[model samples]
Target: MKDRVLDLVFLVGVLFKGLDGLAELVTGVLLLFVTPAKLHQAAGAATAGERAEDPHDLIANLIVHGVAHLQHGSIVFAALYLLVHGVVKLAIVIALLIGSRGIYPWAMGALGAFLIFQVYELVTNPSIAVAILTVFDAIIIWLTWREWRRGRELRTTWRGTVAWVFRRRVAT
Candidate 1:
């Protein structure tokens, strides 16, 4: 039962990683086609109704505020960042799902790096999304470490169990 629960958690974590990758990929693609002026206009248009309904709407205000700070080159940099992260994360997810023993470490390293970034974002920006992402990434990192350790133990035990069978048994 414990194994099953752990497996489920791993599955959820992997699925979340895939989702995150897809989101980044899509956002990056959109960013590639957007200019700061156009993005700001769109943000204003999108949030106008919400802002009108509630002038203090946190989400609407945040979107407007964030868009206001976008510079000409910011979109390009962000697009590149998201695109690279998306591709790497998707590759890691695919490798992990294919059951590559060697990918576990790589996956952990990539995820740990992202988690650190997310933690920094959470601290500096303090958004709900960043906070949730930070927590989930932390959980996934722990689960990944557990998974890697478990794999090593299984391999070790199997090797130990099979070693005696390979040796010649003396006739008694």
Candidate 2:
């Protein structure tokens, strides 16, 4: 039952991570084609008459604010960043699903580093998305560590049992 719950959590985590990757990839590709003015206009249309405190309003305002600050170099940098970040996350999701024993440690390390960065960004910008992602990453890290340790214990126990059985046969 515990294992089932852990597996479910891991799958849910992977689904969210995959969605995050797709969002980055799609947004990056769109930014490559869409002008800032067009984005601003779309944002305006989407948020038309929305209450100031509405989530959509907040997102639309943020979109417009971000577009307002964009420079040509910054746009290119952001596009590349989104693409690379999305690809890396997608790869991690694949590795996790495949149950690669060696990849868990690397994933934990990478996620831990990202969690630190997320904390810094949250402190500076205070995005709910970042906070939620940070929490997810922390949970995933803990799960990965537990899985790795469980594997190690299983291997050790198997080896010890095998050795004990062989020794008993030799004594007989």
Candidate 3:
């Protein structure tokens, strides 16, 4: 029952991250072709008036602010960063879903590192989205660690069983 629950939780994480990666990838590509002025204008228009009271108004404000002073170099850097982050996260999601034992540590490390950065970002910029992402990353790191420990135990048990069988056969 615990295993099932863990598997379900892990699967949810994978799916969530996979979708996030896809969104980031798409956004990255879009950033390449859209001018900052156009982006700011569109975002401003979308967030104008009554929309300011919406829950996601902060996100819209952030986007408008970001593109308001955008540079070409910054656009390229942001695009590259989003693309790499999306690709790496998607790969991790696939590996975790497939139960790749070797990937557990790497996943934990990557998520842990990202969590640390998110924490810093939260402190410096203090966005609700960043806070949510930090929590999610922390959860993933814990899950990966637990899964890795489980894998280690299973491997040990399998080795012991194999060794016992071999000894029994030799004595027979």
Candidate 4:
């Protein structure tokens, strides 16, 4: 029962992560298209600041903005890869835990390392960190879905066992 509840929670977390990924992807794509001057104008409109009206300055601004977006996009892609990998690892760990007699210490260690990697990324490259986080989110979602399915199967099997036991008691 505890496992079932945990699986459900994981699934919800995964779904949220996927949504965050989609949102980042959209934002990155938009950044690629939007001009820096236009972005500045939008930003300035929201606050009192010296408006950049020079064309050259606008070009420089656009270049910097574009580069930032490119970097962000690359980071996001890397994060997506990591997330998928993490999800796969989690699923494998769960399988090993259930199908085998004992817990796999190595899998737990790997999870710990993965978590550390996430923390390191948070501290070092926070600007594009969302990209990595989103990727992990997608992986978590996938893992959650897998766990939910496995939980359903286990539940069904348990129900069958209970029914069989009830029948045997009645017969006795």
lDDT of 3: 0.74
Candidate 4 contains a number of clashing pairs equal to 1
TM-score of each: 0.79, 0.71, 0.72, 0.36
Write down the lDDT that model 1 would get.
0.80
1 against 3, candidate with superior lDDT: 1
Per-residue CA lDDT of model 1 for 30-144, tens digit only, reads: 9999999999999999999999999999999989999999997988999998998999889888877666778888888998999888888887878887888788888888877
The lowest-lDDT stretch of 10 consecutive residues in candidate 1 is 163-172
Report lDDT per candidate.
Answer: 0.80, 0.72, 0.74, 0.50
Worst 10 residues of 2 by lDDT: 152-161
| Model 3 vs. true fold: TM | 0.72
lDDT tens digits by residue: candidate 2, 41-69: 77767666563557566666776677777
Candidate 1: list runs displaced more than 4 Å: 123-125, 152-172
Best by lDDT: 1
Instruction: Encode model 4's per-residue lDDT on 1-172: one tens digit a residue.
Output: 4554455455445345345445545555555555555555555453323224553565455544554444445545655655555454545445543543222334334444665666677677664555565456445534434544454442344455456557767999
Error of 4 at 128 (Å): 13
2 or 4, greater by TM-score: 2
**Order of candidates by lDDT, top first?**
1, 3, 2, 4
* Residue pairs in candidate 2 whose N, alpha carbon or C atoms collide under 3 angstroms: none
For all the candidates, what are their Cα RMSDs to the real structure?
10.1, 10.1, 9.8, 12.1
Give the winner by TM-score: 1
